[model samples]
Target: MTLSVTPPGTSSGPRSGHRLAVRPTRRVVAPEVRRRRRVQLTWALMVLNVMTFFPGAPHLLPIPGSVGKLIAQGALVGALVMALSVNRPLRVRPSVYVVILMTLAVEALLSSLHAEFLLGALFRACRLFGFALVLWLLTPWWTRRDLLLVRTHLLMLWGIVASVVVGLAVAPGLAMTEDRLGGTLWPIPPTQVGHYSAVAIGLTIVLWMSGLLRRSVALVSVLVCVPVLLLTHTRTALVAVLAGVTLAGISLFTARSRVRKAFAIGLVVFTLGDLTLGSVVTTWLARGQDTAELGALTGRKAVWEAILAQPRSAMEVLFGFGLSNKSFNGLPIDSNWLGTYYDVGLVGCALTVMLVLFVLVAAWFRPQGPHRALALFLVAYCVVASFTESGLSEASPYLLELTLAASLVYSTPTREGPR
Candidate 1:
């Protein structure tokens, strides 16, 4: 046999060709490695996500608000960096909601330029940007929808439990705000704790409906949250939870199937249990006081009046004050819509409304399922809650939940594994 000589760079024989082929294979990651890496990233994201809620935890570090903001921004940036470093094809499909968020962020940045406190404006803008960025980074994980949902719920449960422990340890007396037993971590307002616990309860319902979590576990979770919700004395949280559960219940009941019907029954039972628990808690807490006293809007009307009373030029009316303008009549604006209007003007307010509407419409369009139900409940809850709580404009746990709901609603159903 004549041994034919090959060029230096070219394969000469079968072994040489095999070597060349194996060289490229080195770059191909093993499935085990990929799976391990993905799990690590998912856990990292979960930790970061939970940490975003407790930035004010004194036991963790007695950092100031600005420093906490910086830490959150830094963690998000780091997450984005790690996500980018993953040898996976990133899918960024910006929906209408994403566009609105980006627009609001940019608008806020511009408004910040004219803000009284430039540094504060910058901080607020960074926080908003971080929210958008974190949402975007999270989109990739939606490919593993089941895993994502499970991990999210688990992380949320861990976070709430941790908050309870820390709150008890750090500020046991403060847990009972006035007369109600407000279970929240130190430095977090009871209202916020109620809001977030309600959200967690909502997610638990969604998970149960979707069969991601066991009905028993879900019921227990909801039951646990009821006291936390009631303890905050946050009527808004209760209303929001009721509205969300009602919407979700309608969706669950309307479906013509045995499983869905089972889910509806379970949800109904959970709701009844929650309401009974809430009523007992409320009655016990308000045993000596007039029930009408509990109905007070907590001076939210005064805050709105203060904001409306501010003299604004036409330009300011159209494109209102900056994010740095934190107070109305020396009190923080408690309403999300009012805060957005005060900070970024009418245009921003309009955009915010449109975003909510878009999410609602999107939820309506989603095929009748647990996802649709969850989306509708979340959007409705956020919308109703916004009237009482400053949610969307700020970097709080509520906003995090909103972002997750939005992503879930808008994300396409096709699964694309990392390349």
Candidate 2:
């Protein structure tokens, strides 16, 4: 709730031209407005916080990565102050996810006790804990139609998209490395650009089909995001988007829904893609890699084998080697399960498995609706991407997106609003 102080002239003005009124009247703000603002601020803070993950090298800000992270944290603090201005603290749902994430964060903190890079590991744990705390604070708005949070997230994504596009136009060579597009100005990886763009496209299309997003807005989002995604040449994101949308769109096949329009559009896209760029698409997917490299998952197999071959104590196996920039021997461990296992150990891996499984099971029983569609898309994309991308048990965008799906599944609204 918000406080609106009555004007001094009305509340503290002379009364009967004698005694002065001492107290100003307080007016309660609408619950919906308060909730909306709280959710938006909380979500926005989380979005800004994600920026800390990227290294600020050759960045637009021209500052050290640590300094950039501090600036991001400053924004986080500001958003926290605003989010806490409400009348009461929000409560989290009784989700297994709560237990899982708390345990993971605690494990991370404890791992820092024995880690080589003490500060790095501790800060990593803090980021996870902070996000979990924010999720708890956002419980009040976890509803089917919590469009306030969704709109804020979409706006943030659009800003990212626009920034990358600007970077492309301003510095094409820096943005495009070997024909793979990245956010040169912002310093995002090509895979990250593709992932975000794929998410925006999939969510926009699904939301539009569900009648929650305007046709024009959705069209623009897809038209803008799809090109960015394609330019990144991220096969994982491309396949994930197709899989997610196709699976989520199943509910719209009903007679009352706009299935025909969606199907027609899909058909057109597929036909055009096949006729116009089938060979080009194949070459892009190849990425100039040979059969051996392709089969080895771009040399990821060697890294995975090396990670597994490393000798570790039983304690290390249970808790892990602790977070070290999500890398090992100067190579990135891109697989989610392997990365989580290495950073947080077998226990973290078990928790990550439980988290994803719980959501998938819960979504399986959810009735047909926009909420289920989103849940399906988010989970499906993450599941597909996990084999290649890390962040299932860490403070990254994948985990954040999965947390959103968990909220949709666990939220218990007393009354159903219009779709």
Model 2 steric clash total: 0
Error in Å for residue 103 of model 1: 0.8
lDDT of each: 0.67, 0.78
Best by TM-score: 2
lDDT of 2 by residue, 280-365 (tens): 98898999999998999998899899999989999999999887677778888889989888888999898899989988888778
Candidate 2 Cα RMSD (Å): 7.2
Every model's TM-score: 0.77, 0.86
87: Cα error in model 1, Å: 7.3
Q: What's the TM for model 2?
A: 0.86
What lDDT is obtained when candidate 2 is compared to the true structure?
0.78
Worst 10 residues of 2 by lDDT: 410-419
Q: What is the lDDT of residue 125 in candidate 1?
A: 81
Residue 127 error, candidate 2, Å: 1.7
The pairs that clash in candidate 1 are 320-345
lDDT of 1 by residue, 375-418 (tens): 77788789788887775765555566666567567655644445
Give Cα distance to truth, residue 314, candidate 1, Å: 1.6
